[model samples]
Target: MQVSAGQAKLGADQITEAERGLLDFVTIEDGLGPQSSRRHEPDERTDQVRGRLDAVLIASRVAPLTRHIGLVPTVVATHTEPFHISKAIATLDYVSAGRAGLRVRISARPDEAAHFGRRTIRRTDAPDGGQPITELFDEAADYVEVVRRLWDSWEDDAEIRDAATGRFIDRDKLHYIDFEGRFFSVKGPSITPRPPQGQPLVTALAHQTVPYRLVARQADIGYVTPHDADQARAIVAEIRAEQQAAGRAGEPLHVFGDLVVLLDDSEAAARARLDRLDTLAGEPYNSDTRVFTGTAEQLADLLEELATGGLTGFRLRPAVTGHDLPRVTGDLVPELQRRRRFRTAYDATTLRGLLGLTRPANRYATTAA
Candidate 1:
């Protein structure tokens, strides 16, 4: 899986030209940020850095311009309504011909909460105080459940479109997902039809137990940051255990390691490049994932080593987009291909197919049958 910042200044033409069937999935991150306490101040200067372009909308625009690349855009589950996000992703799947996915996120920042003003969060010294994180995760789980139900609300053959009989749809095939939970309730028979893939992929980035459980219970794929093979193994084990506890042990769950990479012809060159970048920025770049400064061949070796710890793939964060993205596509991908680790060409059309996931049966259809 390849990660790209959705808010980056990447033009449609650039994406079309750069995509040469090298990437399996291009994750467009919801760039909503500058969530500092200072943002809440009544200052006009902070406003300039506040808002971001909607990631799903950007993915929708890019869908028609590219083929065979999975477009997974980030959507925050906390502040947004589930009904809207569900239909939006379903529509994306339709437009992308079943190549849509969502990167699920939850907002914990007070500044982010300030944007909505739906509820006020109070901070305390207690372990469970200052806004319950577990509650947020629980709400996120409910949100995903609602979204999945909405996706399955309409059956595959709901639309008849019969000219002879003047039948447009089978009303019986449409289901009302009467979902009620602590956060919100949605009575959803989504406006959009059943997506081509039945369900678009759900993914989340996880670091600890709370998020690991989210991945186990809700996501198709989980992105993890591990400093070493031991950490990778430990994280994967925890997630697997969570899956077992959730009674989804048999399900296909991909745990991918996330890494920030700066690749060059040699390790020395890579280090030099990163150092220069840091110097230009006036601070060393820190990341949740381990930063890799090495040659493509060296990076391949590291990936193969990490795979031994049960990592199915890597979500590489390019330190510099123009420089590292090309190296990943042109250099690292070819090296991995040569090592028989990466695919030479895309074998499947749909994102789920590319990920080797079967299209799930509609829940309502199964119940009716």
Candidate 2:
């Protein structure tokens, strides 16, 4: 029953309340855009100001109000510079005292590109005119690879203090990644020191091979939406295999199942509420995986069933964040705690600890020759 919130009018109070209740963490969705290239959704807030509120600002606001809750911000990698992202995430890690994470998402539509004053990038049409969108995602995967290396460019002990000698850093400890790639290139150590967490967590969602491969290599956790238990296992297997192929099998990479939840006291009441919410949304609430609607106990049982797929955990997207988020924190968490499936109180303060993830060793750490 670990909770995460998104960028909706769902009020920051809901997030604060959830944190007060000791739910795992609150994630604010910062990435914003239109549905398609042609239509613009009606927005009361100015687009320029609103778009900046995406995960970065939201996480910043949430960080100070609550002390222990993990603050994960969604940072879209498609149109952003890797150098800038490296600094921003590092700063977030400092602000939150190492309780920050980044949800690395790849954009799919063209409208988001126009906001950055760049020509729309089409995944389907290749620069060579032969490859498809699949190839473009492969390129994006490489792009993320660059970001990961940049984040790890400076070793943990790179900073030094020698008062009499007047030296503040060990230059030799700083290493240049000198990463060269198809889409972009990066050189040398990060301007910022290694994050407080050594390497803050990076998570990405994947529905296809390219993303799966990217998750296997670049992400600490990979989110997958599978309709059935068997599909979840297959996806995990694929990611594990990719991890081995990429020489990253030693890292603790978690495959978390994603679900859209609508929980209530009874089955009938849950259905009625879901139906009502769908009507409000103006379309039937459909997920690639069938939505889960029932009591919190039933939802917990379903979560346990899904856990058999060797998943680290589940990320439930509530049908209505305002209403359902509270239910998740109040009802579902208590049940999980009773079963010893989740922590009654945060055993550790960092995001990695809350997720039961280990602080990844600095990539530059190696045995002496």
Clashes found in each candidate (C-alpha, N, C closer than 3 A): 0, 4
Residue pairs clashing, model 2: 30-54, 30-55, 123-133, 124-133
Candidate 2 ranges with C-alpha deviation above 4 Å: 1-11, 35-52, 117-119, 123-131, 161-166, 365-369
> Can you list the residue pairs that collide in candidate 1?
none
Model 1 residue runs over 4 Å out of place are: 1-14, 31-51, 122-130, 367-369
**Worst 10-residue lDDT window, candidate 2:** 34-43
Cα RMSD to the true fold for all candidates: 3.0, 3.6
- Model 1, global lDDT: 0.82
Cα deviation of 35 in candidate 2 (Å)? 5.4
lDDT of 2 at 3: 42
The candidate that achieves the highest lDDT relative to the unseen native structure:
1
